[model samples]
Target: MSASVAASASARAEGGKPRGANYARHYWAFAAPAAAVVGAVIVFPWLFTLFMSVHDWKVTGTVSYVGLANYTHLFTDDRFQWAVLRTLYFTLFATLAPVVLGVIAAVCFAQKFPLRGLARTIFILPMMATPVAVSLVWTMMFHPQLGVLNYILTSIGLPPATWVYQANTVIPTLVMVETWQWTPLVMLIVLGGLASLPTDPYEAAVLDGANPWQTFRHITLPLLWPFILVAAVLRLIDALKAFDTIYVITGGGPGTSSETINILLYQTAFAYYDLGYGSAMVVVFFVLILLISMILLRVRTSR
Candidate 1:
């Protein structure tokens, strides 16, 4: 028996066999595939964008390195500046409206109500709808003369205003469309968090003779802060990068009134055939997004 045990031990040592190594080997194997995919899809594209940003190369020509000239031109360009401002404005309204509406909807649905499931499903429908489809529908609805929205306004004795045709109303119209499309997403996220909350604190609050508003302000809001922040951050990022809806809805018009950065970049690259400048704009936007994400993450972690 001793001889046999010694032989087994010797074989194990010679083979470098260890039980803990199996877990490590398995973990690396699983991680390797994901790491390779991320590097190929995300990392490579990011690096390419960075490299392209510094060069003055057309879509079909010999490439020329221009260092920071593209970035300098971006700063000096008035159209780019206006696009940045418009993008910021859109981001602010788009992020805030949905989050506020969502919280309210989640709060309402958190209580036991008849047809609650159906209502929740209805609310989430818009979120699942394709952006291109939504934009197309909204485009028809924003028609100045015969659109449903203007018709409703006329019927309700309100002024029948030009929506997409006029510069003044374009941004607001886009914001309204965006809010309609994205509020359901915010509602779903907030609803999930609300549903997952423990009931004991709410019960205790009621036992202490707290009213609904008091309970919400003191107990519910504080606990739901993390989820709210997450939703807001997600919405903010998406709003910053908004493209398709704006592209289909306004096409960055009535005379650049609704030209967000993404739209500007698209117009620059494909519309005007300024590939290098457009790539620079994209790189700057990417960096801005990364910085904002980091800041938001830091804030969330701190909380």
Candidate 2:
């Protein structure tokens, strides 16, 4: 018995087998359910979409392999091209306006003022509301007639303008709604960044006889850039995926003038029942988003 015990100890002191190896099967058994769920819910649908994109799929018609026909057609389709352009245009303004405004608001809010807490709370109220509800309220305010915005304009001796009813003004009007709802969120992010910043830089600038504008331009802006970039990235992604607000407010109206790629895809798949073409659009959109995300992430890592 002592000899057997000594052999066991010698085995452990040498190259003994790992305990985790014995439980590897159990680990896999526990993880299998979650992996199966993800495969079923997420993986299967995307695979199906990819399959449909390569074929001429329709609800009432027979499916036939198209071999990149849909993708080729998209290049020549004027409406699809316009939708892509509009999506880019809308995304740019929507992302930019909020970041700029939010930065300004954050700077102002960081200073001590009377009722600062109350003001911040009120400012964030719009962000807490559902996007659908916010869009619905803005829809009423955007009415060409019987809208309070126009009423205010007229009362101030200015001409009442058609807000979302006209093609030229629809994108801008929608962007205004986006900026109003999301600027507060950006402000909160920046405010958090401001709170964590070291005081050494500001103190050094003060000793150098820097004026307010000079200090902010040279010191504050540089230090806050990373935070600002983060805010911009978040806003950019949100603006790219924006559909509910645009859908509820304008319904892609004014004769397809306000239609973005998402709206176009919805109309193609559901309205026209061209599942193949719609899937193609979806693939393109996914590529676009992936490319943008990669670029942003690269920038972030480089910085």
Candidate 3:
């Protein structure tokens, strides 16, 4: 009986009935393709960028080793310094504006109102549109003389100021454009969180004689903190990497006034043909993004 049982177990094991180790092997086989895809698409490029950051590689010639020269040069370069500062400024304004507006929009949309569905679709349309197309349309609207914006100002008996011509206004204009495009994304995220919230706390607050403002401030805000953090982090990272709209609208114009880090990297790589330096900038930007994300994650997790 023992011999027969041993033979049966061996047959079952060999006939696709996986043992413990074999199960693990099969599981890895199922996971390997996804892991390889992620590594190839994401990890490999990141590692390559890091490697290139420490070298002086030209587009046409042999690569030379440059220890920390690229990083040091970036610090000293006036254009790069300006780009970094401008990037931070953009991130701050872009992130805050959208988050604030998104919360308001979410609150408004959370209530049942007439044509609410249509209103949401309209609000989110800009985010779905092609960025390049939006940029082109805005560029026309921002034209100094004949643009719709200037025309409106003139009609109101106000002088038409150059919107994108001056360095001071260019960054703000870009921020406005970014905010217009991304606020809906924040709204959607916040709305989801709001929808998921339990009604009991709100009811209890009402019963406790809490006013609307008090309930929102004390209960809703705290409960929605995680979603807010998530939206802010996403917006921050995206704003840091903003390029297409600004590139199309300003082209980092008026003497690089609105140039973000991504724009700087693009100029370095393509216009200046300094592949190695550009790659180093990319590496620095990547590290900064990773650090910021980690910090945000830590804060969220702790809470």
In model 2, how large is the Cα lDDT of residue 144?
Answer: 74
Tens-digit per-residue lDDT, 1-303, candidate 2: 999988777776675775456678889988899999999999999999999998999989889999899999888999999999999999999999999999999999999999999999999998898999989988888677888889999999999988999999999998999899999989998988888889998999899999999988998888888898889888888888889899999888889988999999999999999999999999998899878877987897798
Worst 10 residues of 2 by lDDT: 12-21
Record all residue pairs in model 3 with backbone atoms less than 3 Å apart, i.e. clashing: none
**Model 1 lDDT at residue 139:** 86
Which candidate number has the best lDDT?
A: 3
Q: What digit string (tens of lDDT, one per residue) describes model 1 on residues 1-303? A: 999989878877887975456688678887898999999999998888888889997878868999999999998999999998998888999989999998999899888989999988888888789999988988888888879989999999999878888988888778888888888888888888998889999899989999989999999999999899989999999999988899998899989999999999998889878788888999889888888878998999997
Clashes of each: 0, 0, 0
Q: How close is candidate 3 to the true structure, as a TM-score?
A: 0.89
Q: TM-scores, in order shown?
A: 0.90, 0.85, 0.89
**Cα-based lDDT at residue 300, candidate 1:** 91
Question: Candidate 2, 225: how far from true, in Å?
Answer: 1.0
Residue pairs with backbone atoms closer than 3 Å in model 2 (clashes): none
